[model samples]
Target: MAKPKKISTLNQSIWPYLSPRHWPTWFGVGIAWLLAHLPWKLQRFLGKQVGRLIHKVSARRRNICLTNLQLCYPTMTQNEREQLTKKHFESMGMGFFEMLISWFFPVEHTAPRVTFSGEALLKETFEQGKGCVIIGGHFSSIDLCGGQMTRFVKVHPIYKLQSNPVLNWIMERQRERTFEKTIERSNMREVVKTLKDNCAVWYAVDQDYGRKASVFAPFFGVNCATIAHIGKVSRITDAPVLLYDYYRTETGYHISLQATPDGFPYLDDVENAVAMNKMMEKLINSKKEQYFWTHRRFKTQINEGDKDPY
Candidate 1:
């Protein structure tokens, strides 16, 4: 019999994070704390400059971004694609600072900059004692915009645990505060429970999760490996699937919701996955640069021995 994977829980105590090996982590946190307090505009400026530097230095990630854009935007010229890739790095840079600002400050400070709609849409599900699943893409302003969401509606989010325990704890701690609850991406049992308890769970279906969970679907005109489990969950729980998104606006951020198009979760898994992919494509269309291009979205392929297109 195979051993079950032990889920990592949020440990609230700081004592375990105090060892000498964890000193660097603490040092980085102090620096982030200081940066979080800098004037917002200055922070954004620094983040962009740093992002430019990251684009130049992080060759592997840069290559992945370039390749993804190449695969998705066949109509775009190479030069145009390069320019957009640079801009995406810049968004990532600013997004880092925006995320810090989200983490350190109270909602009172950040709420004014964020404009959210769809509370009533979400409330419609809550009123019936049914859980909702918020389907979204990986937008660049996820952290900053996510932090502001508690002011409107609380959504339990699905996230992966980082290898670094301290970092995971710190992130989960903040998410617990911001989202009301944080469920591990692998914990489907918990996700089912959260929905049945009459709450919302935010999930992004844009990344490669291997062949078992994926059904190849059309994305930006490519047959990309798209995760199919959203349909399974919605089908089982009878939860309404709503489009969720957050993006950087000139002033601050905007978070909104939309109803998923009809026939989203057809009884056929491939049909269901295709619907999810279309929903993600719809969100990405509005905020092209702000989408998470850093992810290797095409790591999986239908071919038996195709090279992993990093």
Candidate 2:
């Protein structure tokens, strides 16, 4: 008998099937395409329906959101947490259809969907000649921010490839249209090459990390395995680290950008990385409602007797 494969982020068996590179991905694309062809009124209606269905079907996931919210926002009432959770899912549905159409449909259609703030921040960073390390959180409309950022400065998003070949092709094509380039995950050499060429690279750090490769950091009062790559890259390449994110607004979505303290004065120390990660946590914490709390942020726990506060 064959040995069972251990489940890891790398072996997320569902990715091959659910990924944008697969046939199932095309199903989502096809639905989005059809929705795009619909009249605006009908499209909005369909989106709302999809959003309702998403909430209905994701009961367990909703509970997870509630749990995460309760942990993060202990002072808030249950009613408030539930309301935010519902809004997150509703926005998620709208975002899903928007992403589908954005990825497959014409770019012009989705261009008007976002309103950008901190436009000058991006331009100023690019003018400095040094490469930038853009850190994004799992907030609202990340897909839109990725597309919109390309309008100003050059950005190379460090993306993990989808196992589904069909969806991967669609996503790769879409991202390439918006950014200067895309770097596949685990491709350290390519990332280095991009930085050497004086180009900015973007990364989302809201996911788990390997034990040996990460420092335990407190995100919402929980110890999560967080990557120190941004600090390491800054130390090596001296790139300016910028915190960038998008959140839903009454008008539309807004892209907020700000500079993070780079050149961590104590480069040869582990504390520098930990400090940077904590700073990131503060930024994400300030916008608790806009955060992707559904993610299993604390999936990794500190080892026994480890005095880590994260």
> What value does the lDDT take at residue 17 in candidate 1?
74
Candidate 1 wrongly placed segments (more than 4 Å):
1-9
User: In candidate 2, residue 36 scores what lDDT?
Assistant: 61
Which 10 residues in a row give candidate 1 its minimum summed lDDT?
A: 3-12
Using lDDT as the measure, the top candidate is 1
For 1-310, candidate 2 gives per-residue lDDT tens digits of 8653422232234445464445565676677677767664565556667766877898877877787777667889999998888777766666665566567555566567676667777778767777788777776567766777776557788887665455565677777676667887677777777777878788887677567667776666666677767677766776777877677665565666776665452454346546555666786666565567677666566784554322
Error of 2 at 71 (Å): 1.9
Off by over 4 Å in 2: 1-28, 38-45, 262-287, 304-310
What lDDT tens digits, residue by residue, belong to model 1 across residues 110-201?
A: 77777888878777867877788888888778887776766776678888877776676677777877777888888899899989998888
RMSD of each: 2.9, 5.3
Task: Please give the lDDT score for candidate 1.
Answer: 0.83
Q: In terms of TM-score, how similar is model 2 to the real structure?
A: 0.81
